[model samples]
Target chain A: MSEILKMAWRNIWRNRRRTLITASSVLFAVFFAIVMRSMQLGTYSNMTANVVGAYTGYAQVQAQGYWDDKTLDNSLDWTPQAEQAVLAHPRVVGLVPRFDSFALAASDSSSKGVGVVGVLPATEDSMSRLSDKLLEGRLPAPTAAEVLVAERLAVFLKIGLGDTLALIGMGYQGISAVGEYPVVGIVRLPSPQLNASLVYTSLENAQELFAAEGRLTSVVLTLDDPDFAEPTCAELAASLPEGLVALPWQELMPELVQQIESDQASGFLILGILYVIVGFGIFGTLLMMLAERRREMGVMMAVGMGRRALATMVGAEMVLLGTLGTLAGMAAAFPMVLYLHHNPILLEGEMAQAMLNLGVEPIVPFALEPGFFVWQGLLVAALVAVASLHPLLSILKLNVINALRA
Target chain B: MNVIEIENLSKEYQTPAAKVRAVDGVSLRFERGEFAAIVGPSGSGKTTLLNLLGGLDQATAGSIRIAGTDLASLRPGQLIDFRKDNIGFVFQSYNLIPVLTALENVEFVMQLQGRPKAERRARAVELLEAVGLGERLDSRPGQLSGGQQQRVAVARALASKPQFVLADEPTANLDSRSALTLLEIMERLNREEGATFIFSTHDPRVVAKARRVIWLEDGKVVSDKTQEPTI
Candidate 1:
């Protein structure tokens, strides 16, 4: 085997130009696949983390039919028991009970429909990262009948901190309710869709305005490990009483998950085509090499080399070429992909607005998982191995006399 | 004992137009340690006979026995083993692997037989020195002259110490002086090493150096002669 390997190594270097050409194809294919996959995975992770962390946390628990109806009638009663049940889970780092209802809010001469989320100020501060997105003023005090409106919503209503706003909407018992509250803060959400129609208030003020003294829409749980969210959610669902459901981020934002999965599939398809091109490039080079060495093969056979040994030597040559190309490509691509993973690329202009409208954050980040790297390397190696089969089969049935004549 | 025996060996190649018989019903025997030459004009079946005897081309009829084993009766793998163990071949064009150095080319056969590195290296060096190519051992085939390349081929042929070495017009590509030198080296190795040497050639210089000569015309051995050394 060592003798065969030495001969194979020599054969590769003998035709320096051909070997380099073959290697370059493998290198370029692997590099392109790694970089493209990294970018796609990065964008997906960034969108999920930023969107979920900024607002929904990793998981949410709502009344079983709340997501489907979203009406005040389906609202879960906000009780101490529900909060305790959610907080008992090991993965639940923080829990916030929210009373969410829609209202027609107006400031002096301007009016708009908005989603009002009534949250416990201190609990929300610890559970969601919304407090950090505040552009002006502060969160309402625990006992104050004050509200926090998104910047875009505030601008549309022409209201500021300390200004009075009227909330007019249907409350529990199918009755219209009206109340007046002061705007305590204005905040900007990462997504434009959220920023344009969201409003926040203290849980007490929400209960008073909606005439629902102890009712709640859902309890949102922030988990320590987002990747285990599905299993944690399943456990929560099992532990909870009937009429309640635990939802992971993926289930909550199914459009986002489907979009990412489709993008990943398309990315791999493109990479597969690139690998086929690389395979053919290597095949062409090996074919030319075999053609040139026909006489040499004949001589080796005449001197007692078996056809199998000759084919084995050629296969070894391809393996060496493939290994070098893959290593070089990985060495060059790993650092670039890792850099992108750490320092995300921010989207701006119309693209940024479009992404924000779709509930995705403006920045795209990469994931530097070892699985992606290993997959790319194996793809290159497999392509080379497949390409080598052509020459190996040809040599197996080679005729020494005809080869010599040629 | 006869080193090589042939009985009614014939080979036919199929063409699009007609069937061509390269060798037809030829019977011959060569004694151990004999330096014999098969002389023929172009297309006279000299190379075909050599190919059949070396187990390189299968004969269409009859059988060939070398060193008491029938070549026609062996399987594909067994034929390869037989060639590796018993037969060595030199070519007219000095078909050395272009990528290999002179020494590596010479050591190739022994490597095929799984010989140890040190032993193969020592034997390769000795053979190269014997062929007067000691100074060119490290040079690739492309770097050597025609005659030097042929000497490397000769050394490679003899490296495995086979019972018989077949030379198919081994000096056809060399100038007269280089041809004489190559023939002299082969003749000396045949005498000193007691290795049987067989040549298929149209070259008179090679024919003159043979201890026995077989002449072929139209795929049949027409004349057989044994020459006495004048010296």
Candidate 2:
């Protein structure tokens, strides 16, 4: 076996140019797979961070029917004990309770329907970083009749800072609700749909105006690890009071999940095509090598080498080539991918603006996790192994007399 | 004692035009330590006969016994093993493995036979030295001259210490000087090691060196005779 291996090693170098070219094919395959897959996953990761971090915290807890009906009638009771019960779980790092309802707002001659959300200013700022998004003024004060209107909403109502805006809506139990509040700030919400008609005010003021004190439409939980969101949601669902259910961000924002999955399927299609191309390249090399050495193989067999032994030598040659190329590719790609992971490519001009309008960051990041590196390496190795089978079977079925004559 | 016995050996090839019998109704026997040559024109079955005797090809309708073991009775794998242990082959093209050094080429068959590393290495060196390639042990076939490569092939054939060595047009590709040198070395090895040798050739130089010669015409032996070797 050692002699066979030594011969195989020497044989590959007999045609150094061919060996290197074949190996480079595998190298390019692994390099492209790693880089392409990293960029795709990294983009999705950034999008999820933006959407979940800015809007739906990693998971949410709401009254069982609140997500479906979304009315004051289905609001969950928000007491000190309820807050403590949620915060006691180790995975739940922070909780922000929100009283959400719809109302009609008007400033002079302009009127539009809007989603009115009341939040504890400090917790909302910590979870959603709402203050960072403020285009003007400050957060609405807890006890004052102040509000932050979304940028688009502010434009539609033609309302500016310190200007009073009138709101009217149905409160809990079908009671009539009305309020007049000063616009404290204009916040830029990333999502175009949310930016169009959303308003923010203090929980105390919203409950007072809606006549639903101590009731919150949902409690968004900031988790320590987003990857564990599903398990945490399961535990929260089981432990929370009756009529409350925990929902992971996937359920809260299914459109984002579907988008990632759909994009990922297309990415795999492209990757599969790349592998097929590399597979053919490797197979072509094997075919040429076999054709060139047919007579030498016949001589070896006539001198007493078995068919299986000859095949094993060729197999070893292919595997060695695969390993050499895979390692070289990884060595070349990892540093580049890691660099991109840290220093993402930021977009500019119209592309950046288009992404921002859709609430997505325009930077492209690469993921440097070792899982993908190892996976791409193994995939190329499998392709090489599969390509080598042709040579093995050809040798096994060889006609030594014909080969000798050739 | 007979090392090889054959009776009515025949081989047929089905070509598009017709079925051609390459070796037909040929009976031959070889004794231990004999240097014999089969001489025939092109298409007269000299190579086909050598191939059958070396177990490199199967006879269509005949029996071949090497050292009392019937060739027809051995399975394919067993025949391959038998060839490995008992028959050595030298080709017309000096078909030494191009990647291997001359010494490693010689050691290859012994290694396949699972000989100990030390024993095979020592034997390979001895054979290469006996073939007058003592100074070229590390030379790959590509680096060697035609005569040197054929010498390496001869050493490799004898590396397993097989019962006999079969040479199929072994000197056909060599110039007169290289061919004569190769024949001399083979003759000296056959005498010194008592290794039986059989050659299939149209080369009169090879016929001159053989102690016994057989002539084939149209796949049948036309004449057989024993004579004093010219060498």
Candidate 3:
């Protein structure tokens, strides 16, 4: 067996140029696969981090079934002890206590239905980067009777900074939730849905207006990694009160999961097509060697070499090729992919806006995990092994006399 | 004692034109330490007969017994092993494995016969030196001259210490001088090692060196003559 392996090794180098060509085919395959897969996964990473990171904060702790029928009446009983206990988990970085409900806002010129979010300004700033998204005017002071209106909503009501707007909504139970609040700032929201109908105010101000103090619609927690959200959320929920539930970003935003799944399906389809081409390329080289070396095969067989041994030698040759190519490709591609992972290519102008609209960073970040190299290497090795079967069968069925004459 | 015994051996091939009987019914026997030659025309079955005797091809009819073992009694894998242990082949093209050094080419059959590495290595070196390729043990086939490669093939053929060596027009591609040198080495090995040798050749130089000659015309032996070999 070792003799066969040694022969196989020497056999490939007997035709150095041809062997190099065959190995190069696998090399390019693995290299391109790594690059393509990395970019695709990187874009998904950016998308997940952007959409879930900035706003939803990976996971959310809300009243049970609140996501289905969101209203001020179905709010979590907020207590400092409960909040602190939930935030004590190692994975949890911070929490933003929020009061979210719908309210009708009216100015002298117009009236519109808006999503009114009541938040601790500093807590909201840490979680969703609300302050960074301010288009004009200062963030409203905590406990101040001030409002931050979405730019589009402010435009619809023709309300500018310092303009007083009347807000009316049904508060907890059947109470009339109405107040006249001054719009202190205009802010921009990334999503069109949010930009058109969002309003922000201090938690203290919202509780007084709704006649419900020390209460929260939900508590959105930010974690070290969005991917950890589900497991963390699971443990957090089990440890929390009976009426509350924790929702991971995947559950909180199923559309994003669907989008990622669809994209991955398409990516794999493309990679499958590439592997077919590479497999055939390796097989073609084998065919050429077989065609040219029919007599050599016969000679070996005639000199007491068995069909199985010859076939194994050929198979070993291919394995050697795949091994060489995989190593070379990975060695060549790793640093480049790693560089791109760190210093990503940032898209701009309409492309940047388009990416932003999809809730992902404009920069393309590659997923440079070790699995990328390992799986790609395995795939190419599998292709080489499968491709070797063609020649193996041919050799096994070889007619010694015919092969000799040929 | 007879090392090889054959009775009515035949091989038929179905070409597009018609069935061609390449080796017809013939009976022959060969003994140990004998250097024999089968001389025939292009269409005759000299090469085919050699292939059959070496277990490389199947005979259409009849049977061959070599060193008391029936050819038909062995399975495919066993036949391969039997061939490795009993029959050595030297082809017309000096078909040394281009990838292996001359020593490796010689050692290969012994290795297949499961000889110990050190034993095979020592035997391979001795045989290579006997064939006059002692200084070229590390040279691959591509680096050797035609005669040197053929010498390596001869060394390889004897490496297994087989019951007999079969040479199919082994001197066909060599120049007269290389052919004479190759035949001298083969003849010396046959005499000193008591190794039986059988050759299929049209080369008169080879035919002249054989101690016995069989003439075949159109796949049937017309004459079998024993003569004293002239050194």
Best by lDDT: 2
Order of models, best lDDT first? 2, 3, 1
Q: For model 3, report the TM-score of its A chain.
A: 0.90
Taking the tens digit of each residue's C-alpha lDDT, what string does model 2 give over A1-406?
Answer: 7878888898888899999998898898888889999999999988998888788888999999888888899998866766777888899998888999999999997999999999988889987788999999999986677899999999988999989999899999898889999999999998888898999999988998899988889999989898888899888776787778889999898999999999999999999998999899989989998999999998888888899999999999888888888998899898999899999999999998887887888899887789998898789878988888878899999877878888
User: How does model 1 score by TM-score?
Assistant: 0.92
* lDDT of every model, 2 decimals: 0.87, 0.90, 0.88
What is the DockQ for all candidates, taken in turn? 0.75, 0.78, 0.76
- Tell me the TM-score of each prediction against the true structure: 0.92, 0.95, 0.93
Weakest 10 consecutive residues of candidate 1 chain A by summed lDDT: A76-85
Q: Can you tell me the CAPRI class of model 3? A: medium
Error of 3 at A111 (Å): 2.7
Per residue, candidate 3 scores C-alpha lDDT tens digits across A84-172 of 76888889887888888888999999999988888899889877788888988877798898999988898899999889999999888
Q: Provide the lDDT at A355 for model 3.
A: 79
Interface quality of candidate 3 as DockQ: 0.76
TM-score of 2: 0.95
